[model samples]
Target: MIVRHDAGRRPGYPAAAAVFAVGMAGTTLPTPLYGLYRQELGFSELMVTVVFAVYAVGVITVLLLAGNYSDRVGRRPVLLTGLAFSAVSAVCFLAEGGLPLLFAGRLLSGFSAGLFSGAATAAVLELAPAERKTRAGFAAAAANMGGLGCGPLLAGILAQYAPRPLSLPFLVHLALLVVACVLVLLLPETVEDPERWPRLSPQGVVVPSEARAVFVPSALAAFAGFSLLGLFTAVAPAFVSGPLGVTNLAVSGAAVFSVFLGSTAGQSLTERLGARRALPCGCFVLVAGLAMVGASLAVELLPLLVAGAVCGGLGQGLAFRAALTSVAAAAPAEHRGGTISTFFVVAYTGISLPVVGVGALTVALGLRGAGLTFTACVAVVAACTGTYLLRRPLPERNRE
Candidate 1:
């Protein structure tokens, strides 16, 4: 077995992380190009958001249904299957058949992401030697964020500079998927024949009474943070192109990248701040970012918009980590898995449901007005979450 070929455990985590990153990067590879699709297809902004929401639907569906499938089979099989789905998604994009293909590609991308979310992360942690498990955890998180951040950036640069903007991004992703499959083949099998992976089924999120105090605030903070991320991921590109008149696809992608980069940077801060401090601190920072976004929409400034993306992303990263940490710590051991799943469901809902609202709002309010409205609403939610956390901090035992 790959795990016991030598005296020391193979440093398979790096490869596993690479595989994880590649899988997630495919999910967002289309962000910068939504404008192209809009122009080519003559679709409304609401359809754009609907296309994006389709991905989240696929993700949440798989998370609820097949989250434990990887455990039942083996990590490698699930990882490979995820990669296969990613490859299919790339093919769907490459087809460029219009809305139907676009939706299919995104939905397939979501399935790949959902599979990676549980399987790839667990694989990364398990591949590491016991001594390196902590580092492995960091790798898993970074791979996820880094992959997501890189997707738009890569697609943007390629689409802007390279020939065949839509086709090239998926072409490149398909090639990467090949490398990911090879890596997965080489990695050690983390799940034994008789493993007990978390059994996450169609059951709704279960927040036991004992965990409610921490769960309420933390989940709210996550909801708000994820909502900010959703806004950017779904519509920031259009906002950049429509109001700001920035035609460069690279610029749009960069704007989206900044937010995720900020989020990744913020998550690192949680390590130092601990759960008690980070949750409230992240909320306030997120509020600041949301206000900046509102101001940017009002004034129509590209730089301000970018800055807001990064700041809000940072706050999201911070609160997300702290919230997950606190919620997990608060839950009774037997019920922890279900509670965590519930937390993610809330978070993903924030990512999907609000973006659709913004899409619908765009019909009545102009893009700028709709964005302003969104920023105000999300900002208030974030601010309230922060204030609540400050007034009633998590227990000291819940500290990082």
Candidate 2:
């Protein structure tokens, strides 16, 4: 097992980040397959959102209850536990017979993400060489957006061209999970206390006192940005396959991947533009992307849809990384994990609630109309956030 010696040597940060990426990839593996599930199970669009929402619920629950578990136990143990959840999630998908199993699978995946969001991020940062701490930020963002982008691409390709579409995707993911687990075993543990394990108890989202000022704008930006992501992740496949008549899962997945790929690219650029500037700019760009998405839905243009995905995803990456960096930097050292957890709790809420609203809206007014409504709502939020940030600028020096 890879263990870190506290003798001023850096642990294997790249390997740890890779493990984080693989684990995250498993979380979104079902993005393109939702259409298949709807056809096979005979469920409504609302049901799809509900199923997706369950994953967020699981993530929030874990963050609230177990977000700081790694600090007490150790990063490796919590990460391994998260991988176990990922394996179980893959199994649930592989064995899914009905909605219950689907919910279970998503819930398990959410739990895995919740555990990972805190533990893996901290591990990557801790493992970084002192000189590379700044780069560690990009590494974490890349692992996250890159992993998320790859999930849909992988599942889409398999489901489109391979036999046993649903089953094959899960099988491939399970194999990857096994590899990730092995990698986790080889990752150096960063937490100092091995015997200081605290009994797990529900600690509702721990927002830091010092971070309160930065948290508002940062979390708002994240909320708006994530709402855009939620739109694509939950319903884009249905729009492509149902309304637009694009039936290929691989194509659908590629479309989804475009947005996340853009997000990864946007994250890479955050270093050039400071966090403060990146936050509002991301919101504005996100609004532009949403406009393109709305236009695509109205005209049924595939290219427009792709553009929207890429643009919106880029905006999300910029805003999200900036928000995370600011929040983490402002948070007190002792409460860093808890504060980050709190930020994610809000971010995940953005991911879940708005998507659920869109799903519900779809029931009354078809996908196109519902999408328009979503676009309108998020645009308002993004505009408000951008305006607020501009009117009241926070200290740029807060960036670490």
Candidate 3:
């Protein structure tokens, strides 16, 4: 949310956002094809989440280590580096030696995403003309979530309807990455006189005393909300194919995409609701979505599962945006960027760790049982936070 201004900046946020979207799309390209991998490579359910979790680990590691790298150097170099990682990730999927290649590919993909997350957003925001700043912000958000949502859908359609299920999805993505790299080449550098190769400085987590009250609940809400995303990308396809009786890969991909679409819709409401109110409101909606997910698992109903994806995604997006805004406002301006970086560490942790737990549960409880348990626990966390927030909402007094 903190954007630096330089004189004579170009007006190309739309192009920057397009670059962001293309880069992110590669991150989730493997979602719908997990089942095919399991059938061909013979890995367990737990392995699926582990593969997904590796990407999160990569992202978190990069965020902690070089999260401010673009600020020190420049956005273009970081973006190009991200695209390069993305291309390699696609290549790993294409080679498909075995599970090892899949994990390596996912880790590389995570590295690309980690680089893209901070740098691309800054690029989009900094590229905007003063008059279009607000719209640019929305464009950045849309590209992030919308691109993530599209990955699964695009993969599903290609894998199901087109040739070479595994190879084709990534092949198409590689082509798109080429386009993104070209776009990045065209974008003007936003950082004024940025170093070509600055020394890397890790930005450790920081939660100022004034922001703790706001940060704790906001982080918890994000943790609970992102669990659904982990569930969908890592585990939902198997659920759809097995219990829900839907074998169409496109449908499976669409199911995953639905949540992200809902997330995008949810984010659109944040400005209207105000960040302070949107956080708790999002938590309540998320809890309701979790309930539906649990019910879908219990009854084996496809419609309810789809419904849960939408509602839960909506809640996640709404709470996440508000959480970032509220915490940044509470922090001192000097520490604001570090504070936001810390927040993303927690959010990505939510998306990664709990998913592994669900995969572990699958061995003992079966997919449906594990999903039901996951939903119940997350719902309780969200509900408690929502109730607490209702009594004591995030304070706007500290907001700048």
Q: Which whole-number lDDT from 0 to 100 does residue 45 have in model 3?
A: 92
True-vs-predicted CA distance for residue 367, candidate 1, Å: 0.8
In order, candidate lDDTs are 0.88, 0.86, 0.90
Expressed as tens digits, the lDDT of each residue in 1-400 for candidate 2 is 1334342433377877888899888888999999889989999999999999899999999998987788778888999999999999999899877999999999999999999888898788888877888788678878988888789899999998999998998898888888888877877777775645668867777777778888888998899888887777788898898777889988899998898899999989887888888888988999999999999989999989999999999898888888888898888887877788788888899999999998999989989899989998898898888888888876776553
Which candidate, 1 or 2, has the higher TM-score?
1
Candidate 1 lDDT at 246 equals 93
Cα displacement (Å) at residue 336, model 1: 1.5
Order the candidate numbers by TM-score, best to worst. 3, 1, 2
lDDT of 2: 0.86
- In angstroms, the error of model 2 at 4 is 5.6
Better of 2 and 3 by lDDT: 3
* Residue 147 Cα positional deviation in candidate 1, in Å, after optimal superposition: 0.7
Q: If both were scored by lDDT, which would come out higher, candidate 1 or candidate 3?
A: 3
Backbone clashes in candidate 1 total 2
- The list of candidate 3 runs beyond 4 A from truth reads 1-11, 398-400
Clash count for each candidate, listed in order shown: 2, 0, 0
* Candidate 2 ranges beyond 4 A from true positions: 1-11, 208-210, 332-335
lDDT of 2 at 327: 90
